[model samples]
Each structure stands twice: as C-alpha cells, then as structure tokens.
Target: MRLSRRDALAALVAGGVGSLAGCGAPTARSSPSSREAAGDAAETPVGDHELATLVAVAEAVYPSEVEGVGEFVRTYTGSRVEGAGSYARGVAEAVGTLDDYAAEFHDIEYASLPASTRRETLEYMSVDDVAPDPDGTEAQRVRHYLVNELLYALYTSPTGASLAGLENPPGHPGGTRSYREGPDA
Candidate 1:
C-alpha cells in the first residue's frame, strides 16, 4: 500500500526515529543551530546534493510499492547523520564514491541515472555482496552508508514494518488495545 507523507511522519514519530531532545518530531529541515540547541551536538548539516543522491539511492533500494521514499529517506537519514559525525562523513564519502563510479561507467552521476540504471549500477558495484562496514572497502562502505542505512530506516518505520508483516515493530506501542487483539485483528 502507498503511504502518505503524514503517515510516514506519524510512523517515524511512533518508531522514535527522530526524537531530538524529547521533541519527538522529524527535524530534517531544522537548521544546524536549532539542532545543536536541541542537544544534538554531533549534528552535521547534510548537503542538498548528498540528500538528493540518497533519495536516488533509496529509489533503487526500496520496493516499488513504497511511497514517499524521498521524504522518508531525508527525514530518517538526516536524523541519523545528525546523531553521529562519523556517519555523516561516511555518507558523504559514499555518495562521492557512487558518483565517481557512475561517471566512469555510465558517464553520469548516480543520481542522474534512471532508477533501473541506478539499480544496475549498484548491482555492478557488488554492494549486496559486501557487508556493511564504515571502515571497510568501497563496496562495504556503500553498503553501510547507503544500502543498509536506507533498509534499516525503512524497516524500523511503522509503514515499512508492515511490509515485513510486523504489525507492532519495536518502539511502536500500537496502543494498549492492540495487545489484546490477535495478529489478524
């Protein structure tokens, strides 16, 4: 099923994906100073190019049935990058690596490629074969910063959890009444 932006935001909040200083809200668009004021000392301002590249990567990785991939990825990845300096650097490096590869083989940036081409580029890079590792080789870093990161964000959200048949994923209370009901209910 297609998830609206509102649904995605609600799911993110329920999953505690972007709870900065008890704000319990998505802060993708929050300024650097605001994020710091909220106690996110590690908050790194992700560049627009990086975010656009991430959205492109998400389009390749996420299932076609999933909607609002851009906003969801931006919100989730933005929050994740904010929480860790190393992670932000890794994401930037990974995007650069992907772009370099795309330019070499496809004569274009990764984000400029069509979705199918982007997926093909990822497959050609062997991202799936490599384990996610921030300090590992290029493929591993891409898996860590791009592939695994996106997958983790998607699966952790309520909308994405439902894709895996998890009606009540961890962190999502789903209400006390849900506990008394059967899985099918």
Candidate 2:
C-alpha cells in the first residue's frame, strides 16, 4: 500500500522508536541478497532498530522491497562516504531530529506518542505551515531542510528510479551512457 508520511511516522512511533535520533521503526526493506545483508551487518554503524526505522521510512517513500532497491539505498547510506553522512544527518535534523519535533509538536517524548498521534503529527508537518521556504530564518531552514532531505532521499531511491524509468547499473552491461544513444544515432 502507498504509505503517506503520516502512516510512516505512525509506524515508527508504534514500533517504540522514541529515541532522540528516531531510530526505532518497523520496515520492509529486506536484504537484496545474503551477501548484501552480510555486508550491511558488517558496515552499518546504526543498530538493527535504527536500520529498521530507516528501512521503514524508505519503503514508505518507495515501496519496492522485492526488487532490492530499498536495501541498496540503506546499504549506501551506511557507508557514510560520498556525502551520505551529511545527507543522512540533514535528513534527521530536518525531521526535527525525530525526538525534538515529536516533543515540540506532539507534546510527548518521540517514543511515548501513540501510533495514531505520530501519523497525525506527520500530516501536520508535511504542509507549508510546517515546511516553509528558506529565508535565512531557523524555521524556514528546518522546513527547507526537511523538504529537500525527504525529496532527495526518496527520489534517489530505486523505486523512484523505476518510476522514472531510470535503468539500474546491472541492467546496462557497459553503462547508462551507452544506452543513452539517441534514436538518430
């Protein structure tokens, strides 16, 4: 099913992930393969609960677990190189560090809120009032950050790529450039 942001957040809260960092949600982003799972286990600094939260949010955004897409993003994020660290941090901060926002808007510890409340709060935040544009102001900055982070994280996902018809690496033996040859060519 298509999970709205509210739905995702609700799930997160329900899973007892009221941690300061927001790393306690259920997820559907399974390992692409045994090898990948092993690799992730070895590489990820975040614990399983946090990983699960990441996966849940990602799947909510993309919903393509069977295809190994969500796993790929999570694995890539764990590496913390190639700007992933900054990207992930910004995303967390945008979401009000998960805990801070939950405390302020939801009026409960991030972990204490009920699932329903989490979803409602998420819906409350996904609008212009909660996510305003950048204007050298803190609130606007947070809003802009959340909007950009969510968009970037989701749009760069495999499901997002599939939706846009962007061929994956393995699909093209040589590379994308080879397939991009125009009809004229």
Error of 2 at 139 (Å): 6.4
Output candidate 1 Cα RMSD: 7.5
lDDT of 1 by residue, 1-185 (tens): 55556545655676555343222122232123322345444545356777899999989988999988887777767665654454575676688789889999989888999888999899899998888776677788889778887887777666788897875667665666755777788
- Deviating ranges (above 4 Å) for candidate 2: 1-53, 63-73, 81-92, 95-97, 104-120, 127-147, 157-159, 168-185
- Model 2 residue 80 distance off true place after TM-score fit, in angstroms: 3.6
The candidate scoring highest on lDDT is 1
Model 1 scores a C-alpha lDDT of 0.72
lDDT of 2 by residue, 40-113 (tens): 33342344433444444444434443244345444433332122233333333333344466678767543355
Badly placed stretches (over 4 Å) of model 1 are 4-45, 171-180
CA lDDT of each prediction against the hidden true structure:
0.72, 0.39
Per-residue lDDT, model 1, residue 171, is 60
By summed lDDT, which 10 consecutive residues of candidate 1 come out lowest?
22-31
